[model samples]
Target: MRHRLLALAAGTALLATTACGGQDSPSQEDGELTPLTAGVIPIVDVAPVHLGVEQGIFEAHGIDLTLESSSGGAAIVPGVVSGEFDLGFSNMVSLIIAREQGLPLTTLTNGVTSTGEQGADLGGVFVSGDSDIESAADLESARVAINTLSNIGDTTVRQSVRVAGGDPTGIEFVELPFPDMPAALETGQVDAVWAVEPFGTVIRQAGGREIASNFVDTDPDLSVAAYFTSEQRLAEDPELFASLTAALEESLAYAQDHPDAVREVMTSYTEIDQSVVDALILPRFPSEIDRDSVQTLADLMLEDGVIDAEADLDGLYR
Candidate 1:
């Protein structure tokens, strides 16, 4: 029983932008409701912010939150830097690369994290059930599919292979949309895929077997993604960011405490099937960023030649 899953394409290409948007200070009009736009990807990872808006958490903090869905961090990073969004959601790798590329940005809060269970994490490298590839090390000469080439997906996958004593250099990474990967794997177009829920769930239900939990292999408490804003935006209104952070923290706690709420909110923003939603392995949403895990990721990135220089960890957070 193959189910068609819909997910915002995670393919990314960071573009340089010089345009600016948003107010110098949060609007004091309409009973002091500040209109803020956030660039986000419409995947399972962003359900907390959606739930926050629905639960009036942002409203309680004097914010009229507007979420603008984009492809992935590739779009969000430039959008946030250009002030097109007051804040944006993205994978940690994108932010680190952006920082190294001279884009001034800082994390507002942690977005999503790994479950820390080897094969039971939210996302993994999966292959067909009947395949001989029983572990990550077998992927040495296999063609793996990842949404983005030089970003987190391939980087963590390579780490998983290396950790499994495989020569990752021979692994060919194919760039495909998340929505297309399941089908590609089913038809043997690629040997494996780095899939995240609810696509991971879909693949499992369709007889795919998870070989490696890349996120967990990278770091047990791997801070996969975060909500971030440009330094200019944070400097423009420190008080506003404080309130926003408070609201976001509250939202994160709420989502963590209420898994049902997170699953419910996912349907509102995406066309994910209800059955798959119920079976989703949701990622952790901690309010505090895992700085050590982030540093580990950065170190791995540097070692893998993903970044030219070491990322400045101090200035990368709020």
Candidate 2:
């Protein structure tokens, strides 16, 4: 069954912006503060970075952060490659695969994590309430929706299904943005969707339920999202890299200590209702990237043939 799985030579492009909400357009000119443009998704995992911007944490470090929202890891990776973004926030799985493909992305800080905390639904695989799919094994020969292919969404779903004795390769992935997932499930456009928060909360509100928890729990705690930049940036400007890292670490501490402030900042960026924010289980915000956790993801990709060769995990962090 493992051998039959579709090699994630899958599409890496991001989903388009949704109808209801999005980030402000990137501004080119700024007078006093240095401009830092980043590619990101408007999910709970990224709230800390934005929270930092709101509290002027980045500005204190001599940077004014602007955002470009991408719907998938594919979009963010390219944004970095094309010099459209100074840094990107995405999952370890995508970063690992991109590095193996020679993208030269380096991890800077930790983003999000899931260790099956009681009420925190960081992310999951879901089917509508009326659907017959009951387990990962039932997903064989079924259609699954993801915001991005060959990234976190693909890797975790495959790992969960394979553990449940299903043929993960037999499942077909249909690309759908996080916002579109609920409608697609209701109209029967797809069998199930793997979504990150607060969309997982959205799915449940729309009468959907998850079949698995900690789908991304490949290690003791899965590194679901991260902040990364090109190798060239690190080589060219060590001061900028160090400043960004230090500033973000402070932001993470502030976010962790003040949930209300994080929620307030999140509402400004994401389209999610305030009610969802009230109920949202904010992801674990760590100060530094865990090398071992990242190594686990790289090893998984090599084992699954998502990457052609072993990635130098140790070198991922500069």
Candidate 3:
């Protein structure tokens, strides 16, 4: 996944003028709503965006918003870069790697964040109840399933092992979708799984034991993901960007204040069980991105060989 993203950035130069620079919509006239599309992962992390659309927040801003689901950042990044999506939702690690490799991208608003609580975070590394792997340290040289390789999952999982006095270099990372992790762990397809809610909640209810809170171990206030757009999109319509940013901020704040609403919104977009939703450990959705936590992720990425150069953060945010 790391190398594939780098290759996308390497080839972006040729597509910049036609793809990134192409206008997806005409200029908005007075009292006209600009239509916008965003590629997002249909996970609990994005409940706020769904709730925002349901509450007519984007409509109030004179924008017609559509949320499209994809597997992960691999699809969302390219969709935004090629103007197929006006905006995208992705983790900090993927965005950092994209920026470092010369993809013209910038964050528009905070998406989701860690709970900053060790055993109570929204995501964690889990194992079967009777597995001999009792802690993060036992993960050395063990196969662990994650949604993406060389991204936030393995990076934070490695950090958890390191913090537990284990050598993280020997760990083996396997890529698997978040929804499939619980089944894989139950069947012993992997030693453990790094999962996020409400899948994490599912695993917990199925007698899976969380050995480590990967996000919390990486950074107490880790800015896990954000809603972003290509620099070209931002430059093309600053007014639309401003209105969408305001709408997103309101959505994030609303989700933070209304936990029950967030839970209710998840069922509309995701196939997660209602029971799991009730037991979910929700992540924080702040209106502002945590730059310090983002930098921490970038540093870890560099150390982990995920990127060859330091990411330029100066113009990475709107």
Q: Which stretches of candidate 2 lie over 4 Å from their true place?
A: 1-32, 214-217
Cα error, residue 85 of model 2, in Å, equals: 1.2
Residue 283, model 3, lDDT: 95
**Is candidate 1 or 3 superior in TM-score?**
3
Against the unseen true structure, what C-alpha lDDT does each candidate score?
0.85, 0.74, 0.87
**Candidate with maximal lDDT:** 3
Instruction: List the pairs of residues colliding in candidate 3.
Output: none
The candidate, 1 or 3, that scores higher on lDDT is 3
Candidate 3 per-residue lDDT over residues 1-318, each given as its tens digit: 677675654544424543324333333556666788889998899988898899999888887888999999876887788778888999998888788767888999999999999989989999999999999999998999999888989989999999998989998899999989999999999999999998889999999999999999988999999999988778877777888899999999999999999999998999878898898999999989999998998888888888888877877787
Locate the minimum summed-lDDT window of 10 residues in model 1: 1-10
Model 3: per-residue Cα lDDT at residue 146? 92
What TM-scores do the predictions have? Answer: 0.91, 0.86, 0.94
- Tens-place lDDT digits, model 1, residues 171-286: 99998888898999999999999998888999998999999999999999999999998787776678888889999999999999999999999999888889999998999999
> Poorest 10 consecutive residues of model 2 by lDDT?
16-25
Q: Provide the lDDT at 306 for model 3.
A: 86
Model 3's alpha-carbon lDDT is 0.87
